[model samples]
Target: MGPEWAILGATSVSLVLGAVVGLLAIRLQGIYFAMSTLALAQMVYFYCVQASFTNGEDGIQGIPRGVAFGVWDLSTDLSMYYFVLLVCGAALLAIARLVHSPFGRIVAAVRDSEPRATSLGYNVSRYKLAVFVISAGMAGLAGAVKAIATQIASLSDVSWHMSGELLLMVLVGGLGTISGPLAGALVLIGMATYMSELREWVTVVQGLVFVVVVLSLRAGVVGSLSGLMRRRLQAAPRVSAASLPGASAHTSGAG
Candidate 1:
């Protein structure tokens, strides 16, 4: 199948799966929801490991780099890169719009305090389920692109470690901000490449970074920087006002 087919198939499957799981799991929150999803993931993983159609760990290999609608040949690395960029750009744009929409506001409201949202006559459960499905579909699209880019689909791609890495990326970059995850991914990828030789210590380093961010910058890199810039802007007016000759004198006289 072609890129379009693969992407559509991935997203559709994820949406279905997410809806089913979310319907069953959305009533639960925090660790319970996390555990439920983890259990589902384990089930999928074992199925992949046992299923003959999945190649039993060897995975689906030799996947062809097919052309895009017969117009762009993805066999060439440059063409494939550009195609990936296009797909990613579109996805990011869609995500931006989604996060800024009224639906997104409802999602945020639900997340902050479900009881309050419910009291306000909002269907918190439905909103949660819908967002869950949307998230899964987005993840599926990413997975589809990844498989195409690497030309391989393996169990490792679905492992708990992979899930943890995705969480870490959002935390490191800053949650609730579009640029945060992108920046976090670039940082993590760059670090991984640089430390490829010292792979054993990579996790240790990442953990240390995580700790530092948690203790000193709860808002994460992007969030912290944004806050700092905002604070500076706010303080600038006061500083300029205080610098005026009459302003200081007036304040001193009042004191």
Candidate 2:
């Protein structure tokens, strides 16, 4: 199958699997839910490491960048990069739109106060499960894209460490914000790439950054900036049209 087909297949499979997992996972709350997911991820990692189809520890390598959409040759790095860029741009726009939609508002309400959401006749459990399934599908799609781009798939991808890294990205960027994940990913990846020579000290830097952000900016970088701008806008003095220099003169003249 081509890259497109592979992506579609991965999404479909993940959606189904996510639903199955969410059935039990969504019932747990807070730390229990996180631990449950971590355990599940560890199981998947072990399976990937032992499964013959996954090629054990070595992983599947030399994956071809099959033609995408029959129009674009994804074999070339330039073409592949542009394709990934377009996909990312579209995904970001979709996420923004989704977050502003009524459904998104309802989800937010559920997140803020589950009891209130339930009192309002919303199915909190269903919404949570739906979100989990959707997120899983999106993750699968991203994995497919990454596999195609890098021409390999590794067992480590299914490990809990990857999940921790993903969580770090969201927290660093701004949890519950639309653009936070992207910003976090870019920053973390940039740090890793540029500071490769720092060796084990790179992790120390990441830890320091995370700690500082948590202590100083509780809302995260983008979230804090957004809140600051909002406060400033509200604090700014408002100029009523009636208070203008010509307003009274014009009114008197009209009268």
Candidate 3:
């Protein structure tokens, strides 16, 4: 079936489920939360395995690259790429705007200090739920696009290994920085693609890279750069202030 409408419907359902899951998971912290999420994902994977609609292990393949909105034809590679690019661009812009908004500030506050945010009368749970829903929706959107691009929908997308890989990308890129994921994906994906023949060594090499990054760039590549920039900025103001006092004293002495 070339029904692109299913993509939107699936995304919406996934987002709602994400919010519901977040509401339930919001109470758990640290390892407990991680385990709960992992369990839920595993359950979904089993369900997919049993579900007839998902076509069992074979998955839903041969998905036709039909026209988007019944207007723009995405059957061609160039057109499909541009369509995906537009969607990704819009998502990035939306995320940037969200992070700069008051709501985003509240979410950040909750992340840094839930107790403090709660004391300030903000429902931290709700904030987490909203953020979870947004993240889920974005993920679903990406998956949908990937399915369309590859002309298949497989269980690999929902696998635990995929989750681990995603976490690795975020950690290597920079947890809080917007550009971190992009850079990490570029580097890691490029490495994986190039080293596809050396499959056995790839994992070991990636692990070594992770160890090096953790030992040296604890804040992550982007985060470390951001910290350096901040320090330089602070130093600049101090240097200017010191120079101002010295210049004034020298002028007074000259007078």
TM-score of each: 0.91, 0.94, 0.91
| Model 3 Cα lDDT, one tens digit per residue, 127-214 | 8889888988988888888889889999888889888888888888888988888777777888899999998799888888888888
Model 2 over residues 1-255: C-alpha lDDT tens digits?
678898889889999989999998999999999999889888888888888988998899999998888878998999999989987898788888888999899999999999999999999999999899989988888898898999999887888878988999889989889888888899888998999999889888998999998898888788988999999999999999899999999999999
TM-score of 1: 0.91
**Mind giving the per-residue lDDT tens digits that candidate 1 earns over 1-255?**
677788789989999998998899898978998999999888889988998977978998877778777677888888889989999899899989998999989889987888999999998888988988998998899998888888999998888888898999889989888889888888887888898888879888888888888788798899999999999998784557888779988998999
* Index of the highest-lDDT prediction: 2
Question: 11 in model 3: Cα distance from truth in Å?
Answer: 1.6
- The list of candidate 2 runs beyond 4 A from truth reads 240-242, 246-255
By lDDT, highest first, what's the ranking?
2, 1, 3
Candidate 3, residue 36: the lDDT equals 96
Which regions of candidate 3 deviate over 4 angstroms?
1-4, 237-250, 253-255
Inter-residue clash pairs, candidate 3? none
Report lDDT (Cα) of residue 6, candidate 3. Answer: 61
Candidate 2 accuracy as TM-score: 0.94
